[model samples]
Target: MPPAHAVTWRNGFKSAFWIANVLELFERFAFYGSKAVLAVYLANTIGLGAQTAGSLAGLYSGLIFSLPIIAGTFVDRYGFRRTLMACFAMFSLGYFLIGLGGMSAGQGLVQALGKTGYITSVLVLTAIGGSLIKPCIVGTVAKTSHPDVKALGYSIYYTLVNFGGAVGPILALQVREGLGIEYVLVMSSLVSLLLLLGTFLFFKEPEVEPIGGNPRTLGQVFRDMLLVFGNFRFISFLVIFSGFWIMFWQIFYSFPFYVTDVLQFPRFELMETIDAWTIILVGVPMTALVKKWRPITAMTLGFALASFSWLIVAGSPTVMAAIVGIALFAFGEATQAPRFYEYVAGLAPKDQVGTFMGFAFLPVAIGSFVGGPLGGWLVQHYLRDTMNPAMMWYIVAAVGFVSTALMLLYNKFFAPREAS
Candidate 1:
């Protein structure tokens, strides 16, 4: 392989690279677009209480991230193209059912299962579909890109992910306003159906050598899971880092209620775009600024910034304040998030790098599973009962502060000396 710098980006990729990325963009688009309105739809449209809505949303999001661990093994057993086909088929059906559950015409089924049960069942199915996407898309990128430009390939992938994140909410806002919120899920279903056809027509399985000689059996994957769980230091790190995601997920889990119920804003979905847009606009500059800092230092500073961002909104409850706070949070995320992977890889035992990297997603899963209920509780307690919504953000900020402090303590004492 040639030096990375000497390789031209155009020549370093195969046809599958572009196809996979395009598919991923729409997949993210469908996921985030529906997610942008999920909590609000549940509360206002489906008549669930705020806490119940948050719990359901969290369950769906949690399953999406957590299932990938097990789902990746299936992707390896099947091929990427086949797994993707199955994924989109489920996405289409699950999203359609969810949308259907919101309409009067769909009342028979909703009443049959109960609204909560109907939504939860479909959401679990949708999450399972979503779980297959990441590994397939990422694996395709790895197989399709030349070794020299693999970094650039992943960078392109990351950019599209954020692009989808940034735009999905905008689309949701429009659909919610113009067509109705139920149509947003229908929109996602339509997109998934298109992706299913695209996968069938355009996406070819990339030819690449299997890692570690052959694909691991499901038994081996489970054994690897056990090995990863046995590493106390790593598990502790993942648990502590989950605080960041718990804080981060508030944008989806709690912010809608805050905007609509408290601030009387009808367009909270648009506000959801700020975080992704901030990352898209400033990611490069932020990466450049923090690239030279130690991973722990960058992460600590990032956590502090994210923590402090909430206080900005807490002190002054206004639309502008909310925007500024979300932007600041995104800056903090961009600063630390890339370095997080670097830190994890560095902490892994040499032979177990792949295994450790795979499990690196655990913090996100933990955060979503825990954060949803927590966010809902905060909304119900602080906003609904106490009539002091600002206190909610203060508590969120405090979590971040504590997490940052813990990271500092870990760096000083428990982290490997070289890592410190």
Candidate 2:
């Protein structure tokens, strides 16, 4: 029988999982804190043109999602603990640079870097560090959980991520309003320091079975990622799902711009509504329900509903309408998210599960990478005019429509087979 249950870190497994969860919260706080104010800060403080700021912020944000493939391979070699410590250090360096840069960005007499050129460079550097943190923290979490509880663990993980997303911005608003956006970067660095310390002291590798083939060390994980992609079906799905994320990501990329520019949420109230209710209450319940729903099916429904909700907000523009639209968006997100990973994990060839998980996150990176410029253009050219507002919705709706069509195709024609 299992040893009597202990709630202490001395219990090893519980310590590892909870510590991972706590670190996940801090990392997300950093990410969402930056995200909460990035676009506005870029345009107002950094003095990039509307188009330039949006494009750069989008690209930087996407990098946070995209750069994991390279980082994951590097970390897999050194082991999760070492990789995490390294990431935290790098993250602190990057955020501090961003804080220093944001402070200097638009001030008079600093035009030597041509204002725009200088700020853009800093954002890109920030992206480099942000990109490394994601897969490493997640991979660490995956390493800690037992197979039977892995699904529950990730669900909890994503929920905490959203919780942080919900809270980080509200905190950002206070700091941004009182001191400045520069402080947001500094704050993220501080939290990252705590997580770095947490990992160095407490994180321990899980007792997992060895792979059938000799496991690739760090150098090998990179070589293996390239080799594994030789499978046509896997690449095809990854490409298709990239499109899905392109649509999914707009909740972050476009919603803030839309709400503030057109719908106009009162201060940080937008994040508060979602954090207070949806993440805290709806997350677990919706996840439990979706456990029985087919992931592809949920993806299809989420895309379709969120697309229509864009139309609803665009067309109505009332406070209640915005609330309704965002609520639908959040609820749909809840239904679809847990399954996204389940489908990936279920499809993996067991021996290379970590590689596949790393691969699956690539689309979030790609979508953000592209969505920045595209969403910026759409907002600037279409939505800002007020008369052309629906066109903005039309474009966003089209993106989701395409994803919905693709999900249907996958469900009907391209889906992977279930294991025996």
Instruction: Name the top TM-score candidate.
Output: 1
User: What TM-score against the true fold does each predicted structure earn?
Assistant: 0.97, 0.83
Q: Candidate 1, 268: how far from true, in Å?
A: 0.7
The per-model lDDT (C-alpha) reads 0.90, 0.69
Judged by lDDT, which candidate is best? 1
Stretch of 10 with least lDDT, candidate 1: 208-217
Per-residue lDDT of 382 in model 2: 72
lDDT of 1 by residue, 75-169 (tens): 88899999999999999999999999889999999999998888899999999999999989999999999988999999999999999999899
**C-alpha lDDT of candidate 1 relative to the true structure:** 0.90
Give the poorly placed runs of model 2, Cα more than 4 Å off. Answer: 1-14, 104-110, 142-152, 194-219, 227-232, 266-280, 342-357, 383-387, 416-420
- TM-score for candidate 2, please give it: 0.83
